[model samples]
Target: MSGHVIAIDGGGTSCRAALADAEGRVLGRGKRGSANIFTTSDTIGENIAAAAREAVCDAGLEGLPLKSIPAFLGLAGINVGERQRELAKALPFADTKFVHDGVIALQGALGDEDGVIAILGTGSVYLSRAGGVSRSIGGWGFAIGDQASGAVIGRALLQQALLAHDGVREHTPLSRAVMKRFEGNPEAMVEFAQQTARPADYGAFAPLMFEHDEKGDVLARDILLDAVRDITMALDAIVFEGCERLCLLGGLAGEYRKRLSPRHSAILQEPRGDALSGAVQLALRAFPPQAVGENG
Candidate 1:
């Protein structure tokens, strides 16, 4: 169709695309590999294009020229203006808007309403909107920030494991298990860490902390509590920013909900939609009927 919209949600782990009509009816969907600007910038264009093409084909529009599609991409690591501009120029779509992944998440979660959202996944970011003013707290990526994120939790687990090995910290089943994963060899752990320093690599260990926490592992519980504290701090900041509504998004949201205080939890609301839906919303706004020369 002339006014088809292609919405993309791109992150460190995977990229998802959905084809939709002007009325916001979804037609088809597709998925592909990582599209994080910092991690996959070299191939992000190819990845986005591939996902869009697949989505179009899935919509039974295999012969459609992609340049006719208006797209919105909400991507991780695109907060850098230069990177956003560069990637926008490289994409194959006729018209496209590049926004921080958090923007789409906020749009999807709150629509036109005012609120705050904390995204806790392989990374974390806090975004809030009030009186048409948008403010962000974190999401500096895994290295310096992203507290309460899976990557942070996972990295903490590894650090505790090493500390336990050195007798600098109390040992626990969780640490022992982590050490066992490296065959009780600290050198092996070091080698692995050196080879796999990416946030996704560290985030792979996050589930192990949860698993051990359920078993009452002290270290694991401590790590989780630390993460919770970080998340709570961000929530407090959002509240101070005048946002009364909060929505938690991403893989770890549920885990965090249970750990949050009742006061904070009370503010949490279900998201109105997802990032892809928000992207479709953006596409519709950016390429309205008049812009597309479409008659009613």
Candidate 2:
């Protein structure tokens, strides 16, 4: 039998895994909850394994040799230096690689090819890889950065609503929509803000911003437009020195694709794979030489 590869794209919102052959043809796909190390505990390896196992099972494989598998993980909090070691002990494959989720996203979108990816989801980040060199922009987390994200937009919406309530701005559709989302209870709104975790939770409401904008809410339109601007700027910052390839990925990115400016759309490229596929690709690279037909 041909060897298999496992790729994982673990993020603040969810974990996805894909099983594939050396040719990159997919075998199975699986999904689970967030596997972000910074947001969760030291059990990140366990969580990632669970998600990968689920994908493997979904692909109708069991009792497979884990050691022979090659795996790649794009996890949210793992940086380039020593922090990756913490994850090395936890993954299933004999050989595994870890990078920031953005790098994984970029790889998924472009493979070994060079390009940039602007990801907007529970979090926002810009990544570019060209001529085997890579760079990043933003993705500092919710506290300091993540400018063009759902949390940022949600926070802005709430702030604007409060301002409207205080008569600082005129009433708008967003105020009504925001109030409705929280069931018209300010306390519930506060509770939602305090209790929820991750950028995706707030991003869940991103559609409302678009809807409000479509309905002619100036504030909502401004917020949406500004989000695009922020993402574009981040992309511009990291694009390869001679970049001609770029792509936008994520739930929000797909939803807002039609609304993106022509300049943004012109450079977009289709993704060659997904984070899960990238994980499987990583896994395949770890396979034993005899099994993979070559040294990984």
What TM-score would every model get versus the actual structure?
0.94, 0.85
Q: For residues 1-296, what per-residue lDDT tens digits would candidate 1 score against the true structure?
A: 47788999998778999998878788989999988898778999999999999999999988888898888899987875588788888998988888888998899999988999999998899998898778888888887888988888988899999999999999999999999999999999998887857888888888889888989999999999889988888888876545578899988888887899887888889999998888888778877745445545
Best by lDDT: 1
For the record, the alpha-carbon RMSD of candidate 1 to the native fold, in angstroms, is 1.8
Residue 165 of candidate 2: its Cα lDDT?
65
lDDT for each residue of candidate 2 in 1-296, tens digit (9 for 90 to 100): 33667778888888887777666677787777887776665666777778678767877887776566667778886763466786787666756877688876776688888888878777778887878888887777776788978778878787777677668988787887787777877777777777873566677777888777877888898888888777666766676567878777877777667776676677777788776655555555555335445436
Model 1 clashing residue pairs (backbone): none
lDDT of each: 0.87, 0.74
RMSD of each: 1.8, 3.2
